[model samples]
Target: MSKYLFKSRLTPDGMKGLLSEGAKARREAVGRMVEDLGGRVEAMYWAFGDEDVYVTAELPGNTSAAAMGMVVSSVGGVRTTTVVLLSADEIDEAVRQEVHYRPPGG
Candidate 1:
C-alpha cells in the first residue's frame, strides 16, 4: 500500500451537507469511501484557508487514489488534489537511481 495526501475544497452543496451532517459524520463517510477502495484514512482535518480539508490515507496505489478523486469531483461536492507520499526509504532508493536526462536547452 501507498500513502497519499489530499487537499480539498468543498462546494456550496458540500458545505450545506457538512453543516447539516456535521464534521464527524463527514469523516466517517470519507472513511467508508476509502475502505471501499481498499484503503484506510489515517487522518482527516478541517482547515480554514485555501483548502477546506486535508486527508492522509493509505491506498492500494495511484489508481485507487485517482478513482477517489474522480468520483468525489464528479459528484459536484468537492474538488481534490492528491499528492503521493513517499517514505524516507523510498526517497533514499529514488536518490540512488541513475537518470539519463538533460535540462531543456542544456
Candidate 2:
C-alpha cells in the first residue's frame, strides 16, 4: 500500500451539502468513501483556505488513487488533488535510479 495526501475544494453544491450535514455524518460518509476505494482514511480535516478539506490515506496503488480522485471529482460537488506520499526508504531508492538529464545551458 502507498500513502497519499488528498486536498479537496468544495464546489457550491458540496458546500451546501456540508452545511446540511453534521460533523459525525460527514466523517462516516468519508470513511465509507475510502472503504469503497479499498483504502483507509487515516486523517481528515475541514480547513479554511482555497481547499476546504485535506485527507491522508493509504491506498493500494496509483491506479486506485486515480480512480478514487476521478470518482470524487466527477460528482461535481468537489475538486480533488491526490499526491502520492513516499517514505524515506522509498526516496532513497528513488535517488539511486539513474536518468539521463542535463541542467539548462549545461
Candidate 3:
C-alpha cells in the first residue's frame, strides 16, 4: 500500500452540499468512497485557506490514486492535488540504487 496526501478545494455547488450535510457526515462519506476504491483513509481535515479539504490515505498504487482523483474531480465538487508519501525506509532504499545522469552543461 502506498500513502498520499490529497489537497482539495470544493466548488460552489459542493460548498452548498457540505453546508447541508455537515462535517462529520461528509468525512464519513469520503471515507466510504476511499474504501470502495480499495483504499483506506488515514486522516482528513477541513481548513480555511487556499484549500478546503485535506486527506491522507493508503491506496493500492498510483493507478488507484489517479483513478480516485479523476472520479472525484469529474463530479464537479472537489479538485484534488495529490502527493505521494514515502517512508524513511523507502527513501533509504532509493538512495542505495541509482542511475547515472550528467548535470546539464556539466
TM-score of each: 0.96, 0.90, 0.95
Q: What is the clash tally of candidate 2?
A: 0
Better of 1 and 2 by TM-score: 1
Q: Which segments of model 3 are wrong by more than 4 Å?
A: none
How many angstroms is residue 17 displaced in model 2 relative to the true structure, after the best TM-score fit? 0.6
Put the candidates in TM-score order, highest first. Answer: 1, 3, 2
Worst 10 residues of 3 by lDDT: 29-38
lDDT of 2 by residue, 1-106 (tens): 8999999999999988888996568778888988887889999999998899999999889998999899989999899999999999999999999989999999
Q: For candidate 3, write residues 58-98 as lDDT tens digits.
A: 99999989998899999998899999999999999999997
TM value for model 2: 0.90
Which candidate achieves the best lDDT against the true structure? 1
Query: lDDT of candidate 1?
Result: 0.97
Please write out the lDDT profile of model 1 over residues 32-99, one tens digit for every residue.
Answer: 99999999999999999999999999999999999999999899989999999999999999999999
Off by over 4 Å in 2: 103-106
**Which ten residues in a row are the worst by lDDT in model 2?**
22-31
Pairs that collide, model 3: none
